[model samples]
Every structure is written in C-alpha cells, then in structure tokens.
Target: MEYNPQSKQEPLDTESEDRFASEQPSEFQQPYQYQEMKQDFKHSGPGIASFVISMVTVLGYVIAFVVVGAMATSVFDQSGNLLASASEVIITIGISVLILSALNVIGVVVGIVGLALRNRRKVFGIIGTIINGVIVLLFMMLISTVFVNAGGL
Candidate 1:
C-alpha cells in the first residue's frame, strides 16, 4: 500500500477489535482463577506444627530406646552386677521419655485443633494425630514394661 502522509491511520474495525478482544482473556477472569488456586493451596500453620512435633517426638523416642539399650548392655559386667552410674543413666532416660511423651500428647491436641479448624492442611493434622496416638501407645507400653520388670505390676 502507498503511504499517505496527509491521512491519519484509521482505527481498527469494530469486528477486528471485537475478535482481538475475544481472543485475549479478560483481566478479571485471570485474577479470580489465581485467587481460587491460592485458596486451594492455603496452609494451616497449626497442622504443620503438629506434624513436625509428632515427627520429632517419634524420632526422640527411637533414639532414647537405642541409648537405653546400649546403656543396659554396657552397664553390666561379666558377673551381671550393675555399675554405680547405671541407675543415673536409667533415670535420665526415663525423664527424657516422659518429656517426649508429653510432647506427643501436645502434638495430638494441636492436630485435633487444626482439624477442627477445617483448613487446607487437614491431612497433615490427621496424620499428626495418628502418629502421636501411636507414640503415646508405645510410651505407655514401655512404661508398663518397666514397671512390670521392676516388680511394681
């Protein structure tokens, strides 16, 4: 087409403008979709905290068990006599177990609260609750065994 310096460029035809506008997405639609996705992925802080606490408590329990087993093995001599420091080690392990058990209980409570909040992290809360329940059961079993072995049962 020849250039016409005297004439202003004509605006797009209405039909072409409408076609272009229709091809491109609406600004409002994009933000609504983005917001919906953000809401879907929203996290529950308490649920996450409960999960983390439960995991830590379970790990501590395992480490405590291993340490206690090692101490029990090492503290006895060939004559089967307990060493002077063996009781202290046992007492320390017992105290740690008690503390971890308490933490597990707290995790369970937090998980329940998280679930009750009906947040997006409910799965984590449920998992945390289940883990804490198992840990509590294990703790009770260990305590009962200790008592039975000590002739307190």
Candidate 2:
C-alpha cells in the first residue's frame, strides 16, 4: 500500500494552519526556561531603602514607648506622689506608639502587595512609600505632643 498524506481534508470553518502552528511548543517552552531567571522590569521603584526607613521609623516609636514607660515606672517607683501623678504622659505616649505601629504594619503590607503586583500597575509601589511616610509623620506628631504636654509648655 502507498502512503497518502493529503488524502484527508482538514476540519473546515477555521484557520487550521495557524492553530496548528500555535499549538506546537517552541524552544521558549523548554524546562530550562525556569533556570533562566528574569528580574522585574521596574527595579527602581520604592525598594529596600524605603522599606528599611519605614521599618526603622515604626521601630523608633516602639522603642520610644518602651523607654518612656521605663522612665515613668522608675519615677513612680522612686517618688511618692508628684512623679507618679505624671502617668498621663506615659499613657498617651504608649497609645500613640501602638497606633503608629499598627499604621506602619499596614504600610508594610501595602508595600509588599505593591511590589508583587507591579507588573499590573507601576504607581502602586510609590503609593506604598507615601503611605509609609504618612505613618511616620503621624507618629512623630503624637510623640512631640506628649513631650510638649509633659514639659508643661
């Protein structure tokens, strides 16, 4: 028997040639594609520096809270009434620190998401950085207010 390659007609109503060409996997689909890693297209967005600064600002507030609490506790322990009555200052600082930490955590979460989804929208990373700055400023104001009030100014 003789081989007949063109004896059968291809399915109609479509571009079978294009479909067949596309269906065939090329060199790009090889397993080695995984080994050939590629970096993100946008590398200059809000990066490690912004992340570090944001974290440091958040941590500064937390450290301030601890330090202020320690000082207030020691004063109360040593003094009979005058220093102990200054508890309001410490309480305000602690609450402010807690609020700032929560906001910074939110900023970090947003930054991570922005970094992950940068392919979809490039501005998200910048937005995350802005959010972090806002968090830092809010905390700064709170701490400054405590200082002013405590100093009787």
Instruction: Pick out the ten consecutive residues of candidate 2 with the lowest summed lDDT.
Output: 31-40
**Residue pairs in collision within model 1:** none
Error of 2 at 33 (Å): 13
Best by lDDT: 1
lDDT of 1 by residue, 67-120 (tens): 888878878889999998899788979899889989999998998888888537
Please report the TM-score between candidate 2 and the true structure.
0.38
Q: What would you estimate as the lDDT of candidate 1?
A: 0.82
Model 2 misses residue 76 by how many Å?
1.4
Candidate 2 error regions (>4 Å): 1-37, 44-50, 77-84, 118-153
lDDT of 1 at 26: 90
Segments in model 1 whose C-alpha atoms lie over 4 Å from true places: 1-41, 144-153
